[model samples]
Target: MPLWCHASPAAAGAAHSEPALPLAGGNARVSPEVSAEQDEEGEGDGRRWSSLVPELLADILRRVDADAEKWPKRRDVAVCACVCRRWREVTIALVRPPLHCGRVTLLSSLKQPGPRDAPLQCFIKRNKKKSTFHLYLSLTQALIDEGKFLLAAHRNKCGFHMEYIISIRGDLSHGSHVGKIKSNFTRTKFTICDLQPQYEGSKVPSSSCRPRLASKQIKPLASTGNVETGKVSYEYNLLKSRGPRRIRCSIRCPIEEDTEIDPRKAKKPSTPGSLVLYNKLPQWHEHLQCWCLNFHGRVMVASVKNFQLIAPAGAGGPWGIQDDDAVILQFGKIEDDVFTMDYRQPLSAFQAFAICLSSFGSKLVCE
Candidate 1:
């Protein structure tokens, strides 16, 4: 059965309320009550719709896909996918991945790499009382608070290091967790571990499996093992110079290879390659006496936590970059509880969110 069919009544109602079809002049809105009635009527006649010709169905879905290009409305595409198996197949074929489209229309997109040409704009909301952070895709504008929920993380102080557990669901439960970021006692060095290996033929590192083995909540999930996919280290300020913090990230990513080989004879895939990123240097404001980077108004507040990441010249092979100076990823403060995160190719939403989590606690030595 389709997942949508098994959803709760509240969820089904919410989905039904959104306009699935565009009228000749504009969108035709539907009330929840009316939509519910329509859904019942559709269900009774499911056989009629299921018999739609493949070509005609594909064309119809393509039109819907093009018409609803943004969220709320884009959800119409998902609605189409849930109607029947035929519609679902057509929708999947018509919808492009985040890497090519730059839009995250479904839950699966969260794990895929971002677009190569432009950065995917997103935001983070922090709950200080709960020590939880929610990542959202910016729906309307760059600084707007309204967004589509993506992933979430909860911070826990475990012994000497601080741990941020990243999950697809807001609850941050072990079952939903995709990965975690752990920091050292001083909060200067950190490691990112994926619950499952990201690349083909890659095995979980034994060293990365130790910490989770001690945790009751993570032990069962980590039985298959966890892999250390990346490391984030804040540069030490030996001189204690007064300026913004400096950070470098080394991410293990899949190396591109031809995909036409027969599976029966194919050998193990090549080991993943590393993609490195450096924090963009900010200029000193003589009058303000603070460091600044041009967020182009995306960021409103002055904060040491604000920084943009750029790939060094010629370090763009893994990211598919033609412009060496382009910002691969950028995060900044908008309000005390709100922040902006924009990231492009070579970094999945998971990697980008984990890197930003490292910026949370104080790094006295670097600050």
Candidate 2:
């Protein structure tokens, strides 16, 4: 278990522990770089692979693994290169594809000017036992914070674009912690029905998706006119290869105003309907107001630990909607990164599926 088992690296750092001493392996003699700067700038001898034999290369890879003492020998293919001259050449060939890890270097994206480790991410970096590991550098916001994305500011833009940055940083104080971490993806799944048409209707056209739309009252956010809508639904693949024995998921959707979603002619809603069938508006306007809270990091104050949507949506929309119609779900505790939840809606006698979204991935605990 990496140091994140209970206490933070900063917490561990405060304990006044001595730094680690290098213990290189094999008979190839420790690379002069070992003493140069742990992993900083080292005097590397760029030797050729043909000069070394295959068995020698394997042992060199092992030596690199042994030297790191913090990297996971199993998952990381990059560390093999550090083992010896030939193995380094071979490892380069394997990891070159995504040789680029950490952070979405897009100017439109911005990250909190601090460590961007997810709990799971934190868990992974701290577990690996190898040296010469990958870091979330080379992709920092400083790399891409220069481009202008007009589409990001528009709600009805033709193109679907969002600017987000995912960078990784190691707890240098603990070598084990750095090995436990890895790179991350750029986009995340988010859909707040009645929030943004683009969001509700923005579908990536994935076949692997298990069709989790609320079939009873709503169709999939994809088929309706919502195509290219800002609405987005992310279905994550919670894998064991990722870090942390458990992950804490948080979502915050804030509705700033009393909005209405008057589908011109929505079918019967979950709420008991007393809408006027003949003279009254055929489509009922469901007024709902919600608060959204976005959390960024750990919780240090008294606050909510989880949020559950009440009677979330099933089958909805693409119905006859009026101008005054809208829906809002506001988020709470945003600056804290806790991502707490808060919402309040009217007691109108209408019908619609309650929203169903959670931090847990769609495939989390399938029934």
Candidate 3:
């Protein structure tokens, strides 16, 4: 049995032997003799573990960290840290390393930053039965079994286009709707616009709750939009991949406010401040007969529905050279019908979400 499974027999015996300090007549007391015996046993149990040399404890924790690198096992490492102060310190030391990077990184980073603001974590869950998908956001790393009820996107199918009804606090039943994401036939481009603001305290929309741009249109401010007209405010473009059966995608946001197309240009002209999201395409395996994405191109067995957003390395268009070290956003598949998203500075939850939606559906039109 593992050390964490059950307490030492001596500790259990000590616990049972201790006198019950009960409150009676608004007073609580314990016999001095029993209290002293309890104290001695408690001290003995503490000393047994605490007496171990710091090096030995650290060695044990290092082994634990190495062993729990997978999904379910990783959760155990989190539980181990909560055992006691000494264990917590050791775990923190091993998990977080000194770094001179952005304020945020993956929680699983061995050299993660010290406790600061918790990074935003989002997951995509698709419901094939309903022909719909939902996007969820949470502050802590969690498995779907943990239940995510923060901000969410519920899908509504409309012909060739799909609409994502945005709601907050799990208001799927009767909550006032907040916004909608409309996906076009190209299946790459999407526009997010705010619906009417919910009246105070009522689940029903106010009489003015038309699907128009509210007085203050609400969307992820991370990526700005180029054009705004009535209820339709933001417009973003999802560029098609260059190769067939490729898992990669490119996104351009806040396209030039000027709508005129330059027919003479071979490629789309990138606007001055336009941002691009790039997905590193995954390769197909001959033996597995399935397309996959893996870290560093080695773990080919794992399915990868993931990508990263990057800015041009220098002054260039969306298709220009990319910086090798800069990673603005990171997202990938975590489990069946679920995916994980982690982003650094300048990327808002809403912007991260819009980029992720471009990942859905097949890009190959002819098969």
Candidate 4:
């Protein structure tokens, strides 16, 4: 069953109606009711509410923010933002990016760097028959069954090249797509492109704002233009060695300068940097006659797709990694159709998911 079907009607409605979170120069959409009320009430009522002491509003919002830290509950933070401009500002100010809090409270969190201390846990469900993939945020500490739906991607074959259109909607319609992953003729290399520009001040033309749910007023920010954010390439094994498959990634995204300091106080680099990730070499288990990489018991199956991504020495820039011992991103098979994907700083859920998608299908030349 689809994860969205598990969501409550109200939750599903909100998911379909709410505008994309403000990220990469996109603006938040004001709810129709709020806009209508404001127009009817005029600035007088707005000023009256805006007159509420800033300190008092902040105090109340801080309590609300602290109380609702996880999703379902985390929707409260976004709700607070939709109330008014003042509340929106306060909500955004109080909420920490996924890099700091390790929580994805808003849609924008999907684009921001992940947690530094720990890799954000997630799972991918593949519908082989349809050539579709769905990424979900594990709601529990351990991977079980249920999760919050994050992004969906469907594979499309165009002559020699293959493309994966990723969207917020499960249907994978063109209107809701945020980005895409395109591969070369041999499928040895793939380029990931964000539909929205990375830099601020860039404008998405009105024509690009196509709503999937036109009647419901759904306008996702992902409808913007394409911007190359990362690339993934597999190392060829001409000899077809018995070793595990090897892959490398180069991602362009913001890097956290200091995770030790308070996230609100820490300074972040304005420009995105190139983050490099290489698969950790697996050891040969002579008795089992197979190569293995420890997944801490999260992964039960051994397959070529199983990999642990780590930063090369000095490739960690602002990530603060002194050595390559830490696993930045790890994906392994947990079941026939299910897989575990865990990623940390310098990699967003979108980027992490795209990398895993590249592991799918057959790489004849690379193998």
Error of 3 at 30 (Å): 30
How big is the positional error of residue 115 in model 1, measured in Å on the Cα after superposition? 1.7
C-alpha RMSD of each candidate structure in angstroms: 6.8, 22.9, 16.1, 7.9
Residue 225 in model 4: lDDT = 71
TM-scores for every predicted model: 0.77, 0.24, 0.43, 0.79
Q: Name the best candidate (by TM-score).
A: 4
Query: Cα deviation of 163 in candidate 4 (Å)?
Result: 0.7
Scored against the true structure, residue 124 in model 2 reaches a CA lDDT of: 8
Worst 10 residues of 2 by lDDT: 347-356
Score candidate 3 by TM-score against the native: 0.43
Number of backbone collisions per candidate: 0, 76, 2, 0
Q: Candidate 4's residue-wise lDDT over 1-367, tens digit each?
A: 0012223446433433444222212243322224545546664344433455788667666776787767667655566565457766676677777888998776667777888788889999999999999998988887756888889999999998899998877887656678999999999899999886333454545644543445564333333577899999998886787466889999997753443222334466456889888999999899988787789987978788899999988888576666678898899998899999999888889899999999998888776
lDDT of each: 0.74, 0.24, 0.44, 0.75
Residue ranges of candidate 1 with Cα displaced over 4 Å: 1-50, 84-86, 197-225, 255-272
lDDT at residue 295 of model 1 (Cα atoms): 88
The positional error of residue 102 in candidate 3, measured at the CA in angstroms, is: 10
Query: How far out, in Å, is residue 58 in model 4?
Result: 2.0
What are the per-residue Cα lDDT tens digits for candidate 3 across 67-116? 65433344444444544556556655554321222222122231121111
Q: Which of the two candidates, 2 or 3, achieves a greater lDDT against the reference? A: 3
Worst 10-residue lDDT window, candidate 3? 228-237
